[model samples]
Target: MSEFDQHFPLFSFPPSKVPRLLNPLVLAYIGDAIYDTYIRTYLVSLPHHKPNHLHHEATKYVSAKAQAHFLKLWLPHLSEEEQDMVRRGRNAKSATIPKNANVLDYRHSTAFECLIGYLYYKQQHKRLSQLLKMIIDYKENEH
Candidate 1:
């Protein structure tokens, strides 16, 4: 178990329970936190920058536009099951809409978050790392 797992036992639910117990939006909710944490932690690990600069840099990666772009580029690489989860998330209706993103981008972002949530809940850390690395690589290639 990771250090956080030891500290927050309540968050460590069995992977098998995920499908039966949680809806897509709930998964995306958890996913939003996990994805944001991953982005912020990665930014902090790089060369030092002002807090505002760091936040600005993170926005380029964390926004709905970016996430939707990332998903589109990576879709062909995903397995059938992963694609299915993405489809489920994209189809889920949400009461709230993001101020900065269009409906299509928002749906894609939700799908991306659902995939992350599935990986995280299943404790597939290695797969999660691979996918995150792909995102980082995409960022690097963009510039």
Candidate 2:
């Protein structure tokens, strides 16, 4: 295991070996949880807030619609390889759709999740942090 695997403990298997072999949808599967954890942890670390209020705040960042928006905003800034990963994810076939999100948003969110999974698997934590911070900072500055 690499140093990251020791510290973060993202998976049972090695990240380098799996990312290239896993399907985009499979990557998104893990990515959804990873992204949710990040958002929840961030919210919990903020100043004291009620559980109900925190859940609501977390939804703002974790929802499919919100993820789609973030993906759209960040797409142009991604490298060519990153863009290809997003495309693979966006075009991936999924059997189910969420009741709350439209098809477009769902696909975009999957792509976003795939991007997150890719970064995580590749151990590109710095790039992932920068991308996530860019989105959060932009949203904060907007309102």
Top-lDDT candidate index: 2
Highest TM-score: give the candidate number.
2
RMSD of 1: 3.5
lDDT of 2 by residue, 28-58 (tens): 9878987887777767768968999999988
- In angstroms, how far off is 85's CA in candidate 2? 0.7
CA-lDDT, candidates in order: 0.81, 0.83
Name the regions of candidate 1 deviating beyond 4 angstroms.
1-16
| lDDT by residue (tens digit), candidate 1, 1-143 | 64333322336565556552567787788878888888887788789778998999999988999999989977988989889889988998999999999999999999999888877787767677778888888887987
- Candidate 2, after superposition: displacement of residue 138 in Å? 1.7
Models 1 onward score TM values of 0.87, 0.88
